[model samples]
Target: MSIADRVRVHSVETLSDNHYTLRRATFDFRRNDGRWQRQVRESFDRGDAAAILLFDPDRRTVVLVRQFRFPAFSNGHDALLLEVPAGMLDAAAPAARIRTEVEEETGFRVSGVEPVFQAFSSPGAVTERVHCFVGRYRPADRHGPGGGHAAEGEDIEVLEPSIEDALAMLRDGGIRDSKTIMLLQHAALHLFPGAVATPGK
Candidate 1:
């Protein structure tokens, strides 16, 4: 379609009773060939969120975390999962949230955070827009691998795997988290290609 102008829309929540978001709408638009067209988009009620896929350039590695993902387990995954350093936005800007996530999850003081892309985690029923980014780290920063494991039910283990090793893990089905996979793919294409080396540390 050439363009679409949103008309009036409304929502009715049933399943959630109070939390399910909905959008019913009509659009005013035209097709490329001059025919009128309409676009209907549905959305859920959710605030913004952020996810950070961390890479240690100086060590040529990316920090990965493993945790008990109840949802995935109930969905039939054997183990919980392999995932990137990620978290909710909490009303913080994507960049700021990412930096905080890196520190809290990996103990790598966020040095340089580069906006990678924004992703829609799911479109079927969730209104989650993931702001993805990359944070650079070095050997000096790995004084320890830190993360959260509080009563809120967060138990995490941080890992710094070589870029080559990380790729191998990706190929072997180890890096399965959707967001983590995307981050690794980005690093493979842009950060590490023929060789892997730490840059600063």
Candidate 2:
């Protein structure tokens, strides 16, 4: 049976609506044995986001950002995370939002961004899908010092790491953010083309 035929939504209760949203949902799942099971789940609804990996083919480098994440800190991980330039969609198209985010977070105006794929960051409890892209950039494209928006409480530090170093970081767990790791590995596989082995191969 299709997913729609296998599940039913009973109700959703809004738990919060500050910056994002939180909801508690009641639903019914049809089991493999044709039995119905009622379930209650809480989900965080932070809208969708877009992320981009900015690479310079000639230089073999990628631009990234570092910033403090309160959630990670609260969960016993390093608060400062190194990740691809990303931001919420906030009513903007995925491609358009990524362009603005790249410039705002990394000081690079990139064109001809190639869409990769969309993936859910946390399918279990968070309702956020990240639209991913890869784009070519050059040093001349840097137009501003990107430190993120002060009014929005962003103190992002822009970073340009060589492709080799980035791959090493991924192998050594230095780069722990999932989206960033995916983008970097994608660059290694497709953008760089045979420069590195596929992970686990």
Listed per model in order, the count of residue pairs whose N, CA or C atoms clash below 3 Å is: 3, 0
Off by over 4 Å in 2: 197-201
Instruction: Give a tens-digit lDDT track for model 1, residues 120-181.
Output: 87877567888888877776776555667477688788887888877777777766788888
Candidate 1 stretches with Cα past 4 Å from truth are 1-8, 17-46, 142-145, 195-201
TM-score for all predictions?
0.78, 0.93
Top TM-score model:
2
**For residues 1-201, what per-residue lDDT tens digits would candidate 2 score against the true structure?**
358998899999999999889999999999989999999999999999999999999998899899998888888876588899999999999999999999998889988899998999999999999999999999999999988899999999998988887887778777889999999989998998766533532
Clashing pairs in 2: none
Alpha-carbon lDDT, every model:
0.74, 0.90
Query: What's every prediction's RMSD, in angstroms?
Result: 4.9, 2.8
lDDT of 2: 0.90
Worst 10 residues of 2 by lDDT: 192-201
- Candidate 2 residue 147 Cα shift, in angstroms, is 1.0
